[model samples]
Target: MATDPVCKMNVEPAKAAAKVDYNGQLYYFCSESCHKAFTEAPQKYAGAAPPPHSSHQHGHR
Candidate 1:
């Protein structure tokens, strides 16, 4: 899964609705809107680090 730089949504690379190559890296998007938004002003929405994982864990009986 790839993180959409614009919306931070998890995107499946093989099934991504849109994708773009910026600065020699490929970015995936969940929708066309996100793709357009990214392409328009990449600097505004690029290089967003993926959301961090939760440190807490739940135990079930």
Candidate 2:
């Protein structure tokens, strides 16, 4: 499963209706809206490295 950059929801790549590839990596989105969100401000989510996350410790992007 992949994560929605906008809502941070777990999303299955096969179930995703939209996606974007950046920096040679693929990002799966739950919907077009999330895809657009990630596409528009990729820098916000991409420029920095995200820390590891857990259910009790959600990581920052």
Off by over 4 Å in 1: 50-61
lDDT by residue (tens digit), candidate 1, 3-56: 889989999999999999887679999999999999999977764552243223
How do the residues 1-61 of candidate 2 rate in per-residue lDDT, one tens digit apiece? Answer: 9877677789999999798888776878888987887888997875544534433454545
After TM-score superposition, what is the CA distance of residue 21 in candidate 1 from its true location, in Å?
A: 0.4
Taking every candidate in turn, the Cα RMSD to the unseen true structure, in Å, is: 7.9, 6.7
Whole-model lDDT for model 1 versus the true structure? 0.84
Per-residue lDDT value at 51 in model 1: 25
lDDT of each: 0.84, 0.77
Can you give the TM-score per candidate against the true fold?
0.75, 0.69
